[model samples]
Target: MVTIKDIAREADVSPSTVSRVLSNKKDFFNPATAAKVRKIAKKLGYRKNTLAANLVKKKNNIIVVVISSVETNFSDQIIKGIQSEAQGIGYDIMYMYTHTTNEEEHKHILETLISRQISGILFVSVILEKENITLLDAAKIPYIFVSIKPDNEHMVIGSDDQEIGYLATKYLINLGHKIIGLAGVDAYPYAGFSRIKGYQRALDEFGIEANEKYIFYGDYSYNSGSQAIKYYHENFSSLTGIVAASDSCATGILNYAYDHKIKIPEEYSIITIDGTNLCNITRPRLTSVTQNFRKMGSLGVRKLIKLMEGKVNTKNKSIFVPVKIDVRSSTARLTR
Candidate 1:
């Protein structure tokens, strides 16, 4: 275990200088002396004791990311954005998964994070209960919600899901799709419900009657997409276009269509939300309303940093990243 004292002895500089140089606080040190200290430390195979250093300072430059699971395809992009931004600013990222729905288990996770002395937290696609919120508030740690909008007033970073739904639905409607089916959009998480509202709003603007039978509410999963297809086939035979909740759900719909020998575009045009790389790989490709996932992540980190720094006017404000549509082969003008 090489220490700063060992490097200081070899470089003939004081331990304080070595510590400052190694920690990147070198503005007060001579450039050549700082360089020599770094060379000696590198030669001695020195590694930082982050936990000990954080203990001494009573805080850490670590951001904890909490997610239910890495089930969505766009999660990777969001993480990439977070890492890129956090690393650039000399912060470390720690991922924690919340698999249990139990409130006690959720409390344990929050307690563990607080014990770590982390600088802040980012909640990705995981909604915290009121009790958990109270715990976080009591701890006085900064946290920002990402990707999902909660009912309470909190700092959140994500797309306008209602606009996403309206954009996807209206694209098909403009292409002569009057009888559109919506799949895998459940009635929870402000995002889901807002998207449903957006879909209905588009229909009403176009004078098309919104039918409840045309909507399939399901968890945003591949299985949910498959079941939506089956349900629509049996219940709504006049469906000519579909708007999916996510790229994975859209892929599931495509898979069901292939297995059932349903001709895409000729039979039904489809558009999905969450424009991840998966959209390009699907057969015929998918037309998607792309959320700025990476931007959401990067902006969340920036906002969290502000809150951690105790910047005034940073709390209680939510940011909604803009979304756009990427036209592709999966959606076409309805000719039938």
Candidate 2:
């Protein structure tokens, strides 16, 4: 609770002299005088106001991690990566969830962080409006988008989802899965649509007809995956392979087939994206295209730091984390 005035009054010096001594601004005060001020300040149990100091210095070592929601495993992994990297650099991180739609809440959070002198922001799977982006620009607060790229041009860190899709399809193709079905996403964020595009491209490249009926649209959930499989069973009865938008979707398909007495890898070969830990616990471990969530999270924080430090300009930067397929027990060469 002790202010510079209190320290100065007790030390019998000007507030400016006390400030200089506390800030370690040498050559402005005699060594003995500075020492005496420090000794008195220590005796008074003085604690420095970090917020005020940061306001005066025009910088802070705090980074705000703004997420739309934390319901997914991907979000947890990304946060871990962000925390690890931030701690290594002697920076502190604070979490703020916007829930993706609450504009007023998001604005209030931004204002609070700005007032508290936050140095940078890391948006995880959250999109910003043009007005919000403009506001951050005007306030001179550096921000980096993580997980998914925003519509506006800004610094972003995410996976090459289209490439991930293509790779998943290609893997199925290499295993001779000619009638490969797609359990697609029916929501926004380019990951779903891009992966569908990659699936179609892989089919086209392999000289196989990409059947529209085989592509079932669903949200990224276990029920959606189950529904897709049900649709596949009812319509594309001959479909022997499937590429899902997420691990949960793939798990859905696996669960449905198990309950219905259908065999996997023998009757159906399945693969999914976002190869999180869900791949391991399935009856037959799922074959998955793994996204480097940790690496993406770490790289995103690093990019944000660089932007905050003025080491990188905010001129449409993009960091694409790569993806790879992990062949497991669920997918096999289609003998049919």
Please state every model's RMSD to the true fold in angstroms: 2.9, 3.8
Error of 2 at 193 (Å): 2.1
Find the 10 residues in a row with the least total lDDT in model 2.
Answer: 68-77
Task: Please provide, for model 2 over 1-336, each residue's C-alpha lDDT reduced to its tens digit, 9 standing for 90 to 100.
Answer: 888899999889999999999989989989999999999999999998876777778778788899866233567778888988887786778888776545677777877877777778998977676777777778888888887755636767888777887898899899988888888464555566677788889999989987777778876778878888888877776788889877878888999999988899898899988889999988899999898888888998888888777899756767888888888999998786
lDDT of 1: 0.86
Worst 10 residues of 1 by lDDT: 97-106
- TM value for model 1: 0.89
- Tell me how far the alpha carbon of residue 79 in candidate 1 is from the true structure, in angstroms, after superposition: 1.1
Among these predicted structures, which one has the highest lDDT?
1
Report the lDDT tens digits of candidate 1 across residue range 37-81.
Answer: 988888889999988988999999889988766345767888988
